[model samples]
Target: MSRKTLLRAGPLWQGGVSPYGLIEDPGAGGLALPAGFGGRVVARSGRKVAGLTWHAAPDGGACFPDGTGWIYVSNSALPLVGGASALRFRADGSIGDAYRILSGTELNRAGGATPWHTWLSCELGHRGRVFECDPYGTRAARPRLAMGRFKHEAAACDPDRQVVYLTEGERDGCFYRFRPGDWGDLTEGALEVLCASGGWEPVPSPAALLKGTRHQVRGARRFDGGDACHYTGGVCFFTTRGDGVLWAYDARTSALERVCDGVLAITSAPSGDLYVATREARVDVITPERAVAPFLRLDRPSGAELTGLAFAPGGGRLYFSARRGRTGGETFEVAGPFRGAWAR
Candidate 1:
């Protein structure tokens, strides 16, 4: 077994009032927030937003800055019953349009948004590969197979090294890294499966693991049912839904640290603050120091689980999907005096 440390940030990540103070929702939206905070129903499963029904079983998603507006990519978790869709939000934070991508793909799962303003949607139920396309949801001529075809859950990029870290959403899922050949281009890359220093053989099968390619890693930490991943400040986080453990990976030291627990979706704010959406239906904010606290809790009449958590490039707004038990699915955008990098 590898070493594990309990995450406890000193004071910096403790308590600080953001410019966006506690705001209360008007009660119309399902979300119950602090004061000054506001929310809007961006889209829904059976209903249409910009002419496209909100994708079913919305699992993982991300938002990309698009000129004065933004493009939000959503993933569907139900195998063969769902697909990936992209919703374009106008400058005013309204849905301008929506479209389909990853068509013909199975179980479009969790993924990360690339700096290139594209979506790296993963196929969790089928080919176990990631399909890259514009936020508009165009069909990719080819998926980035070099990233390895596995039971993947999420992928986050280290903008500095131009490398991406991927997670396999399995009971014994292995962490991986895809180093692209050219900067900013994910078309070609080398795939490496992680393992212990004393052990090698690339886990079960490098061919099935990498789907037939060679390549990286010595830190074989425990990642049970790794579900969501986010990279920032030389640290990457993996939320293992099965065991409800959060694994924090340090690129600088190659150290894998266990952070929080009972977290599902991990979205990194532009300012480097990490937001965690929990199965408990609450959103917690984690500061650079790793201190975490509940940020938002949603109340649904029909019962639901929060998913597809994403922060806008401007950081003033957040878009996420709420799974409404009998009512179906819903998409929402919460905005306030959020603190972070502004749109350039």
Candidate 2:
């Protein structure tokens, strides 16, 4: 019930065995956590709990706070038929219910929470669309049509600038920004692609920005391959899986910085630091400065890809899902004394 948070996780991941003493998970659940840290099984694919059957191929996810509990939303990346779900975490830390919050969709991947607690589920298709969803399942999913219609992958807002930065799901696709007249009102806005424009810069302007994009952030840094991105501490961090690279674009200085390589998916802690799942079947941490270190080694028998991971509001626990193999499409919550930005 009480875990000792880490003062420092020993300089990212500098070597052979983990510097921090992470005990072996006895259940053989394919995860290892630091000393004073532990995990529990919240949801598995084959189980029927809370009056709803769990779905497989769960991909991008987000966690939100509820009236007295928490809700974890995950998308199905399964081709042809992918839907979104919201799993309620009761006050006792157990699941209250799990339901399909957004239905009749395909390729639900990489969604994020708005300040208002609603979610934006991204459709990873040729004409990428973003659907606004309610974690409470109070209403039907609302499609953000004016946002853009392209191979949309990931999006995050800069609260200070009232702009939302977006990433494409292609190797040659571009990075973009959407600025609305007011904060969180994405209904009507101008969308524009980012061009390297003499060494890449973060652009803002509901007036000058393009309404959306068609993989055309002319001149901006193009990835060999990438899918998800987020905005944190004034920087937009994204990953290019093909090139195995992680990038951070500082809108303040207009500097686009490269951070990690061989990265697959990325999620940020409350501290604004990053934990990235690598193609090597391992998860690594990326500090704000771009320092990389091994966080956890995912040892799966058949070898699966870590699709998505998200931190709870306080960063005390992490929920991650993986795809492929026998135990495919499973979600796990790793609990520990996770040092949050607030801790500093």
Q: Which candidate gets the maximum lDDT versus the true structure? A: 1
Question: Which digits, one per residue and each the tens of the lDDT, describe model 1 over residues 192-213?
Answer: 6666552223333433644422
Q: Report lDDT per candidate.
A: 0.71, 0.69
Predicted structure 1: lDDT = 0.71
Root-mean-square deviation (CA) per prediction: 4.8, 5.1
List, residue by residue over 272-337, the lDDT tens digit for candidate 2.
567788887777765544355676666763477776678876677788887776335678787776
Candidate 2 wrong stretches, greater than 4 Å: 1-27, 198-212, 215-220, 288-291, 325-327, 341-344
How do all models score by TM-score?
Answer: 0.85, 0.85
Span of ten consecutive residues with least summed lDDT in model 1? 1-10
- Evaluate model 1: give its TM-score: 0.85
List ranges where model 1 is wrong by over 4 Å: 1-26, 137-141, 198-221, 301-303, 324-327, 341-344
Give the Å shift of residue 230 in candidate 1: 0.7
